[model samples]
Target: MIPASDQDLEQVQAQFQALVMPHLDRLLGFASRRTRSVAEAEDAVQEACVRAWLGFAGLRDPAKVRPWLYCILRAVLADNCERDGRRQRLVSITRLEDEHEALVGGDDDAVLVEVEGRLTGEVIRAALADIPEDFATAVEMHDIDGFKYQEIADILGIPIGTVMSRISRGRRLLAGAVASNQRAWLRDDGKGERQAEARRAARAGGFDGGVTS
Candidate 1:
């Protein structure tokens, strides 16, 4: 049995610091939004980090590190869901492509705009809560995290077409939600307490959109 030398350990640690550490905060935030509990999210990310460190030597390209890390993190989450018996209902995507054929919606920009208006963060998260988790993730990844279609595909280990479909369908659903009740929120200025309560409820349900400067 051959143990890795100190030099090999030092090189790997250096590579990890340069390529992986930069993404730690974002990775934690990503896990936090997806997991049901803070403890779960932290544990999942910790597991993923261990996996990544173990596999660091197999990495072929430093540039692709972001997607690689996400792929590992996602696999951890999926594994947890399956063991907990929630995979069939919560993580299923077998029918997403088939359903993509039925996509009907306006441009992504229009829907994103509507969903990003004042009180829109709360509104968008609220609306996203009602849709499939897979679809919500794609939409939020693109609109909130600024991921490109191909990047999302790599991270999810799915086809680019599926990413497009999820984002499109998700936008359609969010738009409908925003338009249907948008006036109610805008029309009432005296409902500050109600709005705060709504925001609190939203914090419990889903991943928050990142604030773009």
Candidate 2:
């Protein structure tokens, strides 16, 4: 790549700071969901930003910047996974038994009430952590970040069809994980309190679904 002029570099830097910084929280959340480690996610995003800055001159379309940056991030994450050789582990809601126990505080009803809000966040996080990185990234970009399908496609350097497939499959996997966990939690006679707590937690987590009966 040709070296960008100083002015051009400055412009690119400014653009990145303005357009990209606001999305750091969302991106970090995406990374955390995929990597299951907040530190790793932060590292991945920082590396992506560095790569973007270094490659800014090669970017021809300013309008495509968001997708382009995301693409860089995706690539960085893939490289990390490959280097680590960590198999993507499927997270099961049933696996949250220990956490659930901790939240529930040992009493049937009180445990349910105590755990309601905390369980939702933990369950959501675990559910998200279980998906494959590619699918998870797509879901994070399209569903969580609210990027359009076309934009997500561009960001990941994949076709829109692939984006749709990843999102569909990822959601299915996440839903299954959540359902499995919820079922396990409800197996006790204290389900009423648990559901009530789940609803309150969902609201606190900013989930529109609120609570389910």
RMSD of each: 8.5, 10.9
Clashing pairs in 1: none
The lDDT leader among the candidates is: 1
- Report clashes for each candidate as comma-separated counts: 0, 1
Tens digit per residue, CA lDDT, model 2, 78-131: 788678664443333333333444434544665455335444544555455444
CA lDDT of every candidate:
0.66, 0.63
Write down the TM-score for model 2. Answer: 0.62
For each candidate in turn, the TM-score is 0.66, 0.62
Clashing pairs in 2: 104-111
